[model samples]
Target chain A: MRLISTYLIGLVFGLGIMISGMANPAKVLNFFDFAGTWDPSLIFVMGGAVTVAFIGYRIVLARPAGTPLMEAKFNIPSNRALDGRLIGGSAVFGIGWGIAGFCPGGALPAVGTLNADVLIFMAALVAGIFAAKALQTLTANRAAKATA
Target chain B: MITEFTPYQSLAGGVLIGTASVLLMLTLGRIMGATGILAGFFRPMSLEDWTWRAALLAGMVTAPVLMLAVSGQMPPIQVPISKTMMIVGGFIVGLGVTFGSGCTSGHGVCGMARLSPRSIAATITFMIFTAATVYVVRHVFGG
Candidate 1:
């Protein structure tokens, strides 16, 4: 039941991405390009998604188990305080997303479209993720050694 | 801010995404964070833990194919970007998601819906910088 629900959601989400013109990196770039050709369609997409999710989240959270129709605990981020790390990271991330015109969510299911650029983006993204994880681990180890 | 607005299609697609998000939350009790979920798949996990993720990925990968099969056409995706640019951008995104704790779906949709201050801060921070990057890329660098 759990797997089925997740699969169903993913299928629709992928279709939404494709139909909304978001699967195209060019369309994404257009959204970012303010001075040049601008496409504000993504704004509507965001508005619609946010509106529905806002109400849906409330209803789901109101359940005794913290999520409706599920027996598992909610996997929500509890941190509320804004910090330098979050700001700095997000700032840099924006640069990447703008340059590449691909966010993680939009990038994943896009593989189905069988676009070379999407494939390249995904390959590089995987390498980049592992690289980042390694770099963080190295930095932590170095810091620990210094303390020792 | 306004240019080439795709009102109906965008709204319809957006609603679908919202429904997916809500259903995922309600059924799986998980945040629909693409980056985290994908990353978690590569890492080691018990079979029971991995099954749903694999099934979800299968669905995602198959969605466009099914649409194409039924509709007789698929959307075109053209990205005229360099290999170096791809690697660099991907690296930054990976790092950023880790530090920021979420990407579009996680922070923008779900987190904002929950009224999370951190998500709001992250979203605003990314939005400002994305705008700046766009201006510089298109205007200054002519990308």
Candidate 2:
């Protein structure tokens, strides 16, 4: 049941991405190009999403505790510290996004298009994720060794 | 060339995305961060976790068919960059999201809606760099 719900939710989210023109790298790139043909459309997408989500979350959270249908409790992140990793990672992600105009959210749905380029990008993305995990482990090990 | 501004469709689509997020929250109490979800799908913590992630991913990958039904055609997807650049960008994006702990949907949409200061900072940082990168790519280098 949870799996079915998640799938339906994912479908709706993907459809939203498709309808918003976000699935198209060219359209995404245009939004980033201020000096060139800047399509202010993406901003509206964010605005609309945030507005609806803001309202929806408040209502959901206000419901009695342990209210979620399937889960025992909400799993929202509580980390509030502004850290170097967050800023650095976000900036790095931005550079990549600007370069390709393919954020993970946008690219996943595009995979259905079966474009070779999209497949290549997905492969790289998976590789990158593995690389990040390796890097994380390496850093942790180095830190432990230093402390020892 | 003036880029086409699509206000209605973008907003409507955003609403749908927001709805999905809300539904997920209501049902499983999960955040709908694309990178995070995809990562979990690949390196699942448990069988129960994997099942939902797999289901969500299946839906996402099959969305083009849904588009075909609703829009009467597969949504057109254009990758303006070269294959080499796509790989580079995808890798960087993957690394960034893993480190940042969220992407646009997680940070830009849900985070902002929840009014998280960390997400706001991250969003601002990424948006600045994205614009800068675009400026460099399109204007400076003229790629």
Question: Which numbered prediction scores highest in DockQ against the true structure?
Answer: 2
Per-residue C-alpha lDDT of model 1 across residues A1-148, encoded as one tens digit per residue:
7778778889988877777766766777788787888888888778888899999888887886554575557777767778987888788778888888888888888898777778878887788778777878898999999999
Per model, kept true contacts as a fraction are: 0.72, 0.83
* Residue B125's lDDT in candidate 1: 88
Best by lDDT: 2
Ten-residue region with minimum lDDT total, candidate 1 chain A: A64-73
**By DockQ thresholds, what CAPRI class is model 1?**
medium
Question: What TM-score does the first chain of candidate 1 have?
Answer: 0.91
Measured with C-alpha atoms, the lDDT of residue B58 in candidate 2 is: 84
Local error of candidate 2 at B98, Å? Answer: 0.9
Q: Which candidate is the best by TM-score?
A: 2
Candidate 2 Cα errors over 4 Å, as ranges: B1-3
